[model samples]
Target: MTAPRTPILAGNWKMNHGPSQAARFFADFLPLVQPADDRSVVFFPPAVSFAAAREAVQGRPDVRLGVQNVHWEEGGAFTGELSVAMAADAGAELVLVGHSERRHVFGETVDETVRKVGAVLRGGLVPVLCVGETIEERRADRAEAVVVEQLRPVLASISAEQLPTLVIAYEPVWAIGTGVTATPADAAAMHAAVRRTLAEVYGAQAAEGVPVLYGGSVKPDNAAELMSQPGVDGVLVGGASLDPAGFAAIVAAAG
Candidate 1:
């Protein structure tokens, strides 16, 4: 049988690259992503680059385009916000929601994130819903509780059958760009916790099929061990994604 979950290596190009840069970056990077392999590789540039990314990977079957964020409403009067339809129209197969940055920087409430997840799924786009605990939360030994809380709100908005169309990313707030990567064992334990929570809410099928990714300062060196974990399916890359070679190396490690 194929692996339990398709390994997904996604890049979150946060606020970087306009269309021109996006096209150039993809041109440089797409060749390394082999769709024939047993993995799904996706990338999200700033909203401005969705068009460019779609064009860049048009004929290449391996590269999938995603949007960094989206509005819950399909469209209408939400200036400065992109709707789920807008992202799909721009050629995105996935729409990232509830990332750490969105929560900490944009003042996005859990309720808002839940609505966005619903919008992404209803619009025929996969939702990459992110959940994580802050440094303080981790220090206080509340990481599991924090993640559980985040998952509850998002799960509340999605239908049981739609679970497969969603990806859950667990990114520790303190590990993001802090050069503090969690040990593989620690990350694995969290992934298991996520799986348990999923099973509790949506049943064993959802728990078994739903892919959970670990995102927090992942590099080529640690990627292999991370993937070897029973519960860690893939990763959500950040700064490393900006460098084509660095990202490719990590993908190779995943294999």
Candidate 2:
């Protein structure tokens, strides 16, 4: 039997907090959340605050720090782009690749996402690759197809050895930041599809080890119900994660 995937409650503080704010958040929130062996609490602070965030989580093995985005190239003349090595130097243990904003708003292509994923692994960091369908695609009954297409190239780029370290978040465009969450049933169905796709690309054993997380409009009030669904191993929180009390509650709900 496949072991149960560890529940990961990752907060994506996208363009929200700076170093001081990040430090304050960790100081206030860390004490509120007791350490857990079966769960992980990750903070994806803005690149600028990565160092502070990392420092805040120091000595706490349960809490990990990650960067929102990283450039695929190791070193180059790319202006204002952060390299994976730079993120690692800042104490980031994980990186977010192909986030919805990076894909839909910033126009990150699938190939770029694949390269970024590889770069993160090469830099010795795990990757939380985001994949999801837009409202239009869901309305047209292409949710599964869209997710499959978005994930295929990136998953293909990762070798079987790297599969165990990867995390996938499914955040429907409409639900993200809109206070609209997919029903627990809907989320479970999509998560199942995601796992099936992983199994198809790799194998059942490898796919079972991967944690599939839901990200759209996740909050403390609904976190427990969502997490209880089949195939949903965790959550990638957005606006709700900005508040220490709110995020801590969500993490508690995950238990």
Query: lDDT of each prediction vs. the true structure?
Result: 0.87, 0.93
Off by over 4 Å in 1: 1-3
Stretches > 4 Å off in candidate 2: none
Candidate 2 lDDT over residue span 49-111, tens digit each: 888888888889999888899999999999989999888887888999999999999999999
lDDT (10s digit) by residue, model 1, range 92-175: 899889999999999999999998988888899999999999999999999999999999878876778888898999999999
User: Per-prediction TM-score, please?
Assistant: 0.96, 0.98
Candidate topping TM-score: 2
Counting clashing residue pairs in each candidate, in order, gives 0, 0
